[model samples]
Target: MAPMNIFDNTETAFQLKSDSELERAYFLFKMISMEPLVKIGSAVTKFALNVNLPVEGLIRSTVFDHFCGGVNERDCMGTVDRLHDVGVSSVLDFSVEGKEEDAQFDATANKVIELTLLSKNMEAMPFCVFKPTGFGRFKIYQKITENQALTENDKEEWKSIESRYDKVSKTAHASGIRLLIDAEESWMQDAADELCEKMMEKYNVDRPIVFNTLQCYRWDRLEYLKKLHQRAKAKGYKLGFKIVRGAYMEKENDRAIEKGYKSPICESKKATDDNFNEVLAYILNNLDDIELFIGTHNEYSSYLAMELMEQKGISKSDDRVWFGQLFGMSDHISFNLGAIGYNVAKYIPFGPVKDVMPYLIRRAEENTSVAGQTSRELTLLKKEKQRRKL
Candidate 1:
């Protein structure tokens, strides 16, 4: 039989979308392609939601429908099933942002554990994700990283944070579900990294039950990956790496400039891509002690990963390697790769419309910042729609 070509089958890629859904997606990307409009529209949407204007329906049917799985987990079930039909797994993410109170922390932690419990025996939902700040305050992390001494009360608070993480990770491990600790900004990352390592030490004895997201756009991540693997090997644990090209590039640059320090990010996209691919190769070489999830929208990176797998003679369905993209974007990469019997999953973030505005704004900004991303989505979508009419 001929070798599977992978990632040119738009028919399977768009099988999940209807004619109207396809039109809406095309229109959405076309609008997002206009950078200025996305910025202005994001600001307008934020304002409208701030004062409790009645725009939920408008927002829900447009961008929310296009990007998010739904307003809640129950609302996301249909999307989960559709993705399963096409052989793609779902990594359900709670997309709500910006909560700081302790009660809020417990609530978010409960919801995350709830998500893990819900996916316990489900094949369609193979993984679940949680942001560190979702379960605890970000300032606490910032303070902890600043090397400041903690007071008696501060010590108690730190204990609470640890408990929260323990609860979530333990629940995921117990439920036989793999969990990802999403990466934050460089400033707050020290704590997230430490926590992930600790959890890996605990639950990753037999297999990788927890994963840490590594953003390769940062200049030091290649070295960081090396150090992480060294520690994992010395400590006798499996390290799960969900590697991406980094999301907060512009923000990282602005902060570094303001703070008068060299940027942590790479100077150019090529450098970031180079670092990413190199680290990925390193992971494949160490698959005995590592598992990898290549989370990228870059087609060449995807091709490179497949090539590496062939060179290494690893089975396409090897549990040690997987591919992931966010929901609603990169359909060609996700669905086409999945259809070819490779392990592929998409991050399907779901939450209330108003609460998820931050995520929506970031999605808009990402499409604008990443050159050709929006246009690429538009091109593949147009191809599929045209092919559909035949």
Candidate 2:
């Protein structure tokens, strides 16, 4: 069995954080643990930003600095280098959201391509990620997912979206960098999944340069993965997947109820955990054909992956396996894993302060909602504080 409490080493976990920074993290998690404060603060922040209130500085100093790398690729290098010093790599995530225009989509695509080029020689950053909606409108994906008839303009729009994806994927392949395509709402995910597979067929010829996400909250994901694996095998291409526990459970359930359809989400959190572990085991078992990026902060999942890898005699530094966590969260897992020679990366989110508020707010709300996430963070922070005697 893998060692228990391997993640409890506060010294290694917070080795990079200064006394002040540790206190700030503790305070931030404390604030996030209060569900009511997060709701009220999210609303007020939105209002303040909309009315041109001078809250950007305040936001940047506290949550933004802690959670985000910076506003742009160049701005993020310091954080990137810092993490790399401790053996953890980074995935630069441009976290801006809610765009409905062609120009915005093109710009996002261009930024991703530019970032991929920038990372070509940088060992600190080996990966790039972008959301499906970042390259096109949500409605387009939903329409295609539902198999509804598209207007002529929709076809043109979708073609543009595909062009954007192709440009980014080609650049990533050429630069020898891996690209992660994030999953979104279930209504729109089918279209994204199909497009991602197409990219994998084109770019993942030698290895997995293009990876799609599997949100295991949905019970059907394991079956979907099995079918996709069969297709990839027949088509003669490698496959890569980033497995996540999903992010939109409440929205998924509420939408299902309103539409009078069965929810695609698993019925309980335990079921979701089971589904995630099952899929993880499946991909690990098929590492010959599929490379995996385990994107979770759950300690048990991390430990399980370690145990499974041990049982299979996989090297701790196997290039085909990676562990990932978001920046500013789960330092215990990220840093300790890196310290022990596991391949790990942090998803470093960055964007303009005002534009990335939605992402930041969602992070706060998610921390509040996920059971034990905030408390665990607080516990580690406290332990680190005591160790530092600060």
Candidate 3:
């Protein structure tokens, strides 16, 4: 057996994937590393979809297959089994987006509840995750966040959303499965934050069954974490915080420019990384009252988390702390950490190919924007490929 450090490269991580698959991954990352190509490809793909072109097969073979779990909950089981065989768990995330209708929202909520129930007995499937906007309108969320008064009909609609949040959370608590609420854009985050806080207060009264995600790239999340910690301290509830550097940086900055307000994003990547590590240190220091999930692809951040755990005398297997990378992007980190008996899992985003095209595009954009992400993934794949003599 290897030592307990997360830095070691485990050849076993890619044992199940074939040489052809490895080459395909290398090609994909090579394509994504070209920022101009990504921009043009995203535009062309969207245009093709708009004209109802036959693109599903093309997408399914490339980014979708590489990144997603499967098309649906049942479809993801085989993947769950494979990860479990390697001692890594799955945090299943449903990736359908652009939903705003009442019926659509209700169905999404049901799917989330169903996933939580499914996780109840499955050791491989450890957690369920969903976005709040999947259950309610974005406009309503914005209005609520801005403290705008709602008409009677809108109030009733908001009540319906609250009921849906309760159902998913209560089901997670009942099933003994933890849930993560994904972070979204800044304009409507207040509503999402408030709803997540409410659910955490209720479901986390005993244990951390519900987790609130924080985007540390926002420049405000360090203080936000502090405020939540104080509230958890005063209200006698555990704070379940999953911190990420963030998505939606371009969107957030664009909207801020359009609205003539200062951007909510950090001025630089270093600021975000520094604040993320600072908040991570605080979470580790206050492990008595917080269950943390460090959802990041940054290897240095992962190493920093492991270092913090060691300094605090927290075991590598500590359940309260977890390191997460997306399902396809960081097999090196995920498998190495899992191989060493550290608490870790892949973030498995799943949905139909067409319904998930937006997510795929965002993933591509994130890779190109996150400075060397694609290069890093490509380097790791090439290293593994060379070792296997592929």
Candidate 4:
């Protein structure tokens, strides 16, 4: 049978969810499927939180609980242990977003360092993740990407950013944890890529300790990967990447049209899928030199990966390859693959309720935007609900 057929086993897919938890997930995806509801709900949630309405509990009990591991590391321990029991690993992602102050950057960096140290002793938690903008100002990265000359203050800020990157990456290397540095907007990604490559060179000597993300929705990423691979081979270091179909397509396209430049995103979803598959194949083919973390929610893509690995006689449990999805979504893929001895992980986001709202809201909005994703989630969840006679 095809690998995708395994995903139909909802019994294994949602083995961890209680009947009530399953119902909540079904309802959440139902809400997410309605685009207008998502928009209105997002605005209302933001307003309620802004006016200091006592809605954190409600938020925490609903979307926050379903999508995130917990509000802090201690709060997430139960989740870590539970996932580990089923052979799925966790990457504790600090999902707080939109902060720009230097102090906040330092705090985020320190949090990553703390998580790296914590993950060193936890079998379930194998990866630590943080956004590039989480460590510094987005404008500074934008300035660097645009090749604009920075003032002394900007240079100082850039230095501080580099220091944060080095500090976190060095800690991860020492702890023997793989650090996944997330990609952001196209304009700022160039600087992040350069910084991640620097970390890879410094720490990936013995193995891949630092992984950069490639948003394959962008037409240029495959070529960029090829070029980066050549550079890493020449420099005597391994390259690690977490490849995704990207998250900022609408924003990227809108910004390109507004600024009179070509859009970085592919022309259509088909093109993005093709590019993602191509990049996946490229990394799999060169597994000796490149370690891959396949971060996707599409079933076909996941099945294609499994097929390719089998065709090449690669072990299903290869350390160089991993499959990842978000914490709440795509349990079918995560759990089913884990059941079969694949290296699978869920990106478990955790932060304060208020701080993680932006990330949660984006996840909802992105779900609504991605054609068929929310509906597919709803369908699988409903199937599970029916199967359990709930």
Candidate 5:
């Protein structure tokens, strides 16, 4: 293989100095590099106007434009076409979050179903992702997970949750679009897992129509993956698993410490990386029985997966194995993987601007948390700026 620097290939192409687009990226990096500033700004804004303000313009100019398809399904069509032009596809993930009402849940479910239906006609969209919390109350999920007896009202709410999922699953199945249930915080995860398993049994019979995300940073998740695989095998159905390093390590650890319980997170980053690679190997080894989605921003992990495919004699274009990155974080990985003819798709998120504030805040915090992320972005912008000067 020829020597390749993916970042150089990706970042150097767009001139940073003369490019207005590149300057906007510099501004975003500066904003997200300080967590205290982001938090204080968010608090002030929320206090001043009892609503999530429009942060989309800042996001759109930098992260969203680079990573997301667009603000809505209609807006994302151009993104879909562009990715398809390069042999990649898109997965629609509605970015709205933090809903507590049954009516809101029902509406969110309906929107997902509509998106799935729309995806049926669009060749570029192969998968649709949803969060159970988007349609179910968190406290209700907590109660069920804790084995609390449900009151009549709670039972009615649970029924609505079931119906909402059913609507999404049925639409996705009918439309031939896959559904990926995103993992949530550890406290609320048991219920989400139960719900996902139920959905899998119903919709994943003939094929793996629904996937449950497994965060490998959780110490128990590798074993969970194995157990899930065993269940799928015994049931004589295919299993779909989306493996990720995780999104909420800090929160999970802090809560565990506060409650005086054993932390569910891996003890170290190495441990998480090991578990992630092991799960990747296991899925690839059992390729016929499991469909795998490798979701990460780590370049080596992505490369290792490709290497594993070569070792196992699996084609790089295998439909069962996919490479996914969040909508706004890793264009270098996504675009280069797409360039190499791999089965790649971005997790495209969209909603009205205010409803997506939580998602945006997390994105900012994550970039800041990952050491060197902002600096790396700054370096790339600076390098590209200097290159333009040449």
Candidate 6:
């Protein structure tokens, strides 16, 4: 009933550094936490992508450093090891973005398979994640969702999309790697959800190999989750569900307004948070039929889920439920949860720096928009700096 205090141990939370690394990490964190730097970096990324110019250097040194594991899988080995050392696992996310061609789609699918194989070979990497847009054209996805008839070319495109998912699902099943299909924008999401369902049916028979994301910020998502659970039960397969407060809120609302339709987004943050916690409760209570990944940065939601597990007498090591945070933004939450014996993983995104600039820019923009996020990071860095003076 009481609110969760995310920073219960304020002293330890602020102690990000020890003797040697204190000054350097503090300065880096302060620089990344600055509002103007994030704002300008976001603007430059948008401009560069619009004009088709290189943005690797600027992005790599700024937002990418704060958010992403590294620029490639090989580059991320050290990061994965460091997190593993501290008791957290890694979810390998190939961060390639904005691919619109058939060749690129096929390549992305193959890369995801390769990543799954790599994760299976590593003890520390437990999961792999992909975005449906990475392997399908957005317009094609929108058309499918709308039930529009397809031309020969469109049918072929859809076939390719199906083939890509099939390959990823099959590979993941073979590799013993859990695959998370991320939720996307509203227009394309219906098709994405359908594809994920198909994959789950094919791959999650004995164990949950494919997990579909549910964005609880959408007003319709609670009903959708219930329907998906019913379908999973009827099909005699366990459903893997990852819950999050939606990302793409502004874009979804803008599109809805432009098209003269009611927005799918919840009217306020409270509504979204309420739905998120409710979904968490449902999955935790029905753990036999469902596997859940609590993908959130919100402290209240995360701690509440943990408390629920305790109340249900679930073990801390239960693989049926896991917690995830993005690679860069919430080290306090991720590291502290890991330290407290939770099954936690950081979503470690990696790709060519230029290719992942869009992701990096979004991280910058999100940190700027989220209340107290930048200030919290700044305060932690300053506190660490002062601690080193002792």
User: Best lDDT goes to which candidate?
Assistant: 2
**Better candidate by lDDT, 2 or 5:** 2
TM-score between candidate 5 and the true structure: 0.92
Q: Which residue pairs does candidate 4 place in steric collision? A: none
lDDT of 3 by residue, 1-390 (tens): 223444436376676578888888899899999999999999999888878899988888888888897889778888888888887899888888988799999999999998888889898877889898889999999898889989998899999999999999999999998899999899899999998999999999888989999899999998988998899889999988889999999999999999999999999999999989999999899988999999988888888888778777899888888888898788878888888788888888898877888988999999999997888788778888888975
List the candidate numbers ranked by TM-score, top first: 2, 4, 1, 3, 6, 5
TM-score to true structure, per model: 0.97, 0.99, 0.96, 0.99, 0.92, 0.92
**Candidate 6 residue lDDT tens string, 1-390:** 323665444354434334544444455556557779877766767788668787667666655666777877888898888888888899988988888999999889988998999999898988888999999999999999989888999998888999999999999999999999999998999999999999999999999999999999998987998898899999889889989887788888999999999999999888989999999999999999889999988888887988899899998889999999887656677777887788999898888777887776776666666677667766765665565567
- In terms of lDDT, the poorest run of 10 residues in model 3 is 1-10
**Please, what are the lDDT tens digits per residue for candidate 2 over residues 105-139?**
99999999989998999988888999999999999
lDDT of each: 0.89, 0.96, 0.87, 0.94, 0.80, 0.83
lDDT of 4 by residue, 1-390 (tens): 345598888999999999999999999999898999999999999999999999999999999999999999888889888988999999999998999899999999999999999999988988999999999989999999989999999999999999999999999999999999999999998988888988999999989999999999999999999999999999999989999998888899999999999899999999999999999999999999999999999999999999999999999998999999999999999999999999999999999999999999999999999999888888899898898896
Candidate 6 lDDT score at position 182: 95
The total number of steric clashes, by the backbone 3 Å criterion, in model 3 comes to 0
* Stronger candidate by TM-score (1 vs 2): 2
Clash pairs, model 5 backbone: 67-327
Residue 185 alpha-carbon offset, candidate 6, angstroms: 0.3
In lDDT terms, how accurate is model 1?
A: 0.89
Q: Which residue ranges in model 6 land beyond 4 Å of their true spot?
A: 1-39, 46-55
Ranking by lDDT: 2, 4, 1, 3, 6, 5
Off by over 4 Å in 1: 1-5
Query: How does model 5 fare in lDDT?
Result: 0.80
By TM-score, the better pick of 3 and 5 is 3
The positional error of residue 216 in candidate 6, measured at the CA in angstroms, is 1.1
Q: For candidate 5, write residues 1-390 as lDDT tens digits.
A: 322476465442332124776777677778788889878866764454354455557645665565455667888877678667766688887888899877888888988988888888887888888997998988888898878999999999988898888889888878888898899888888888988888888888888888999999998987888898898889877888899988898999999999999999999988998989998899999988889999988877887888888888888788899999876566667777777778988888877655665776677777878777678777767777666668
lDDT-superior candidate, 3 or 5: 3
Which candidate, 4 or 5, has the higher lDDT?
Answer: 4
Comparing 1 and 3 by lDDT, which wins?
Answer: 1
Q: Which whole-number lDDT from 0 to 100 does residue 125 have in model 5? A: 85
